[model samples]
Target chain A: MEAGGRLTEDALIARYFAPLAGAGADALRDDAATLTPSPGHDLVLTADAIVAGVHYFPEDPPASIARKALGVNLSDLAAKGALPRGFLLTLALPPDWTEAWLEGLADGLREASEAFGCPLLGGDTVRAAGPALLGITALGEVPAGRMVRRPTAQAGDRICVTGTIGDAALGLALRLTPEAPWAVALTEAERAHLLDRYLHPRPRLALAPALRRFASAAMDVSDGLVGDLAKMLRGAGRGAGVSLAAIPLSPAAASAVAAAPGLLDTAFTGGDDYEILCTVPPGQLDAFRGEALEAGIAVAVIGSVEAEAGAPVFSTEDGAPRAFASGSFSHF
Target chain B: MEAGGRLTEDALIARYFAPLAGAGADALRDDAATLTPSPGHDLVLTADAIVAGVHYFPEDPPASIARKALGVNLSDLAAKGALPRGFLLTLALPPDWTEAWLEGLADGLREASEAFGCPLLGGDTVRAAGPALLGITALGEVPAGRMVRRPTAQAGDRICVTGTIGDAALGLALRLTPEAPWAVALTEAERAHLLDRYLHPRPRLALAPALRRFASAAMDVSDGLVGDLAKMLRGAGRGAGVSLAAIPLSPAAASAVAAAPGLLDTAFTGGDDYEILCTVPPGQLDAFRGEALEAGIAVAVIGSVEAEAGAPVFSTEDGAPRAFASGSFSHF
Candidate 1:
């Protein structure tokens, strides 16, 4: 907690993480946790890592870093139509990290765990000589043979997305340039809304049940809508024709795009949207919409799956196909 | 492939990790993997992370680094008396990392996965601005409600350990000081044996079934015998009296200790000895030994559990209680 001296690994774990360990975690003392599978449920596995300076700024709060680390993994489970059960965290911290930072991170993780019904089962904490790297392996359970896969979308299926797209990407843009000429035209509340979307992702766990029942193929859009949709299409050996104008955009993002038409490419191609991109059969569209609305979520039909085997194509309102400066974000 | 230009994240994953993915991995294109549990089996979950400078030297072989990353997690599953299932990997790589290094790492991971019967399920790869960090979440399966735990050790149990102790510690010492007067006397084979023990740990998965049937408590010794045994005792509300002379040591380690008598403290306190440390009933000692022998593993009884709530005490051949120079390796 106090860096190297006076705070041993055992004491640090006991003080910061032992209390967060839920049932089956053995109070963070055991080598592994025992988790009984619910009868007739299959397990879903997803692992994600977020690094300081790469995923978030070094000036970002520790709580946001922790939330984003777990939130990204949770988003994967939600896309897979699985209910969150538990997770294991592997944290690599620098020597300069402080006890107060760990406390903030634990507080954020605890809040997310309780809110999402996913508890911290077990984890490893190691000292790093580099920037902090936080990883989470989240486990979820879905009924046997019920997981929504990315390779099962059928031709003619209606492609839909939850919440809004491009908000987080625009929010990131705003964060990097709050005083830019285009950004200064926006209201302070609009700026905050965009920034909030970037910092905190709301994984659609509430929609998993609905998605399980209605979606033919689904995935979380973390790497931009155009690129992630292309991945899903490639996996399914199918293609799609999406309407860029139909894609839902937050009011703040819409305002930004209105101020600078060139920002549309950034809105469509930037990553970290954390929204579900799924194909729903036409027959289930009404039911899916009703269920999502009942759950206080917004759903939009953005496109239709084409019979051709190719990448998704985004077209403008005038039927001209749009080309992004970059298809999606990639680390390498 | 280049670090950040021609070798994209997708291409890097395809080149290095796609072939390592086992059944239900969905070719690593999907955001998450689906796994159906075998009937009557519960999951044993464990995670561990190792950083470049903290756990291994930056110049260590990529293959050994990969093995250590996965081996440490597998060791946890072995300690829980579970069969290896599958694992998720999260890797943070620096900009200077090379394709050849990843190739070697993938080769090592593939071999270990095949040897341990634990395949890759899915993973996330991201770029970092600092030293590499690798995290693994290894899962296993045990019969429902039958996971071996450290807190189940009985007072009258005989504390047994698998294989030789202190070899890895000695190996580390030799690595740090090959030209030292104490290390210069070792034969080439002896030095290789110690170095191999430190670089590639053989997780005692073969002993899991025997432990499940015979042991009262079990855990992998990664943080040295002195501290880890104390941890087991504290967990079980018991104590142990271990005879240092009775603790099994490799021929190479024994010779090293003979050369430098002060290395005994290092042997007892240094970490990275990934062996199964367990407690068996005195009555089942013979049967446990036989089963372990049949499985091609050596078992040694080095201590006895005592009916007291305290730390473990190590005694020399003359019955003098030994004191360690350091309790255990702590990164914080």
Candidate 2:
């Protein structure tokens, strides 16, 4: 067709995508992919999109963008207490794409796909007149009737989070800042840690099994802990009291916050954390923590759910409520 | 959250998407959705995307855009001999999006989702600085190991296509022509017929069961019959010889072709013909045709597979090979 159109498209798939195709993908030749499920398991589905300029800098590395695209959807599956299975990718590329760019992207996708156990299925690639967009729909599996939900938190359940928070937010701030102030104050290792967390978030997939076994309610802390916890509380028709002093933070984030108290607001309101925020019953907190530790993940009890329904209260060590100028990061 | 960002997003989902969510969507409150697969079946996954100004006209109706986004993916499932199940949608909206536009889009998606038995599972909505984009990953189910493939056509297989092939190509030609001469020559009903074909393609899902039972190789004619047939043949490691006279054409398309013989190339090479192109064995031809008729679909045996592996040849009534300037319409 159109001189080299058909040949180009066929060759592109064969070269870049064929290697990523799983057993059900038919080497990317069939119109669709076939995924046979484990008889008694249920499939968890989630879709997410990242557009150029909105989600990442145009100058961002293609590999990082590719990993982020798949990682975001994987985070959703982890929050749902499902194990990553496979995914479909839709790439809307601009006219200026190059062979090197494509190779970089493929390399990144291959790495993430292998790391997460989510092989590529069938997808469409089309040219766009505007900025490029990367979209992915990830599929996961869990035992029947066992998916962790966000609206099942009960009164007296302890609010818990995995890993650390605010590193990504502070990292993004550092990345965007011109002649960054943290550059001189923080050690080189700490700066790199924050930047790495911002560019490549490690979704708490290791905690999914434990969450399914013990968590009363669960959601990924994407749009800041303050806002996401508020959403979970609102959905459960309950309230939460989070202790600012108990919130887990990376050593780098703590140093930045200590250096400039104003940075604390950025940590609380900025998003892109990608850490798991879950509620476990008081009786099961010890068990959940032990299991999480066994899985090589740090778990911390940050708050408790209350029967009274209202905005989540963030209390300081002095028992005074801390207020944020903004609740969560919103692209709009 | 930025003033109305989160609130607007919540309102949009509540107003337009909540009604379309299936049983496992959890009223769209959870980050992901759960789908229980039917026992003894494999899930067929397909994904497609459409961007403004590339796949459709900027001024086209929002409802039509929505249908095309989902319709393209449905055609993939049909070609694979699968039944519609559920889908996840990701939308990247421009700042100018309005409630009215969203309502129209939702109406179209809802209508198609119901008609195809593909319900909304879960999705993400995000803001973009560029043109809007819509992507969908459709899920379908078929009996284990029963999916129709493209690499099974034998040497003696009869190449058949459903419905008419050239209507959509001709319809698109008429649409792109400003102050068109054909408009005055064709009747109002005929003109509308051609326009409707271009705007909304009917995926041949009704004939899927027959295709699975009788067809040896199959694929939907998205990138024109000649090119797509060549693809099937390439996958099967075979070649084909088609008779140009045997190609089916609608009354409107027949009239247009009669008026301008040169339009034949456009009819043969233009893409967006969502009809099914399949190859049936000689022994199963009768059964396939009978079943297709019962399903109220037109089936035409316009070609035959050859032993040689090469580009497909299109022969005229005089037995002379006819050539097209291009094989298929390619966006690249």
Candidate 3:
């Protein structure tokens, strides 16, 4: 489980990649992985890369790294309401990894692939001296006309979100300083909840059908809520006003906020939240919530889209507008 | 161009990736690049990575790097007799490259994209500390029944190759030692031919139709004539005898061999020859030559496949064999 040691590329591939089984094109040996498109569905494909250090902790378990790598790409397909088909993985590995680490990583990929109903089709592996990097290209399919896009939101659409926000960011803050006052006071269950959110984010593929049924503009919340929502607004050529008080937080997160007022910064700007942030027309909100409930996804109406462009307004419970120091994580 | 400079990931991406004119998917800007399968042809996809020191001169022009990055993958598809379709590029940039270097690289990609009739589909760009690297996932397609594979060669197959062989290897040697005695004697046309072979290898897509007409199995000779042919034999589950004297060497390469007695080592083991190596049934060799001639491709008989499996035997003009110090490049 050591972060930087114990895996040869060949051994890692054998342990982590060999057992993947599926009914896709040719079973993992050719130069390119192939998938036969289903008759009634449109094929959706996407590729994303996770660089070491920038995306994950260098010391984190390889399994967690693998999950995050594949999970993030799948999350995009989920937002499009596509059914999982298959994926192609490309890896650049540092020479120090042992066989066990790679096996653990592949175990994570296999678990996610099966859990999400997608199977590994093919991939390439190489050696690198720098941090290990991964590029995963995922393929999916959806019935014609069901895929959602970010530029289609209506002026009066209600902005909605799935699950609680800010917890993954909170978990990241705690991991950075485990001895911080907020971290020391957490209950075991709360700590585990935060850690799990940081480690393994579940892409909401199951909710895709309902999303396509009702949502207008849709995208995963990867950058912080304020930033990603702002992007969605820009993509749709609109704007939104969010009720800061209405932003959902776990009980533990609320407690952490109470203890350390600065935790709000983590809540607003920290990235890696994979939950779907979407816009639904006012009349469809009720039906959308009902379907999401049936699908076991937490649904919340946090704001409404504006007809014109402006900065997102955040309001406190007392109707006082609050100020945010930063909007999102900046690559620069 | 210098080899090791730092460039921001965003700046590199902007400089190197032109706005793809007709990319079919919107998810390309979101979390992943998307693809919708084209109807009719079976999609042929393949990815290959070129590391700085391993694949080319550390200080080669970025444009040449860009061309070769894509050209190598196209060569593989060409060997399969597939038409050029589209490509996804993944670039890991060393920090030192300037904006101009990246622009030149993009220009090269754009040139090849147009020349090969493949459009730029999607890709990821990132920064790395070690060597500059490129991973290209090329997608092509052909009619279901026309695609060729390496395992289809039959016994009594008349192994043939398109174009002369040793030019690229000789070019590499000249590039490595520009002032070497052997390189100094080359005329202007010969030097241009050698450098062009090294820098911008034609992928042989033009000969794909003829290959379909005559070749039982085909592949681009990348690793070297001996080694790559060994791979084809392995794929076909057969072995063969090669006449070293019959192997076609370019005029410059022949001169280099005459100048230095051991220069054949460069011809035999040096890599990056992207010419097509194929097997035609003995009875079809005449027809194969006719088709190749009509297509304006040079065809030469090099060897024949036997019903046995082992190391390939290489004999000289007098039928006496000699031992080869090395046959191909091995990453390990």
Q: RMSD of each candidate?
A: 1.5, 1.7, 4.1
When only the first chain is scored, the TM-scores of the models are 0.97, 0.97, 0.94
- Looking at model 3 chain B, which ten-residue stretch has the lowest summed lDDT? B1-10
Root mean square deviation (Cα) for candidate 3 = 4.1
lDDT of 1 by residue, B182-255 (tens): 79998898899999999998999999999899999999999888888888888899998998888888988888
Higher-DockQ candidate among 1 and 2?
1
- C-alpha lDDT of all candidate models, in order: 0.88, 0.87, 0.77
What shift in Å separates residue B320 of candidate 1 from its native position after superposition? 1.6
Candidate 2: chain B TM-score against the reference chain B: 0.96
Candidate 1's residue-wise lDDT over A1-97, tens digit each? Answer: 3333656777878888888888889778888897876888989999999988888887788888888888999999999999998999998888688
In candidate 1, stretches whose alpha carbon ends up further than 4 angstroms from where it belongs are A1-6, B1-5
Tens-digit lDDT track of model 2 for B16-67? 8999998899779889999876888899999988888767776778888888
For model 3, the superposed segments whose C-alpha errors exceed 4 Å read: A1-18, A21-27, B1-18, B26-34
Lowest summed-lDDT stretch of 10 residues in model 3 chain A? Answer: A1-10
Question: Candidate 2 has which clashing residue pairs, if any?
Answer: A1-B328
Cα miss at A233, model 3 (Å)?
A: 1.5
TM-score of chain B of 3: 0.91
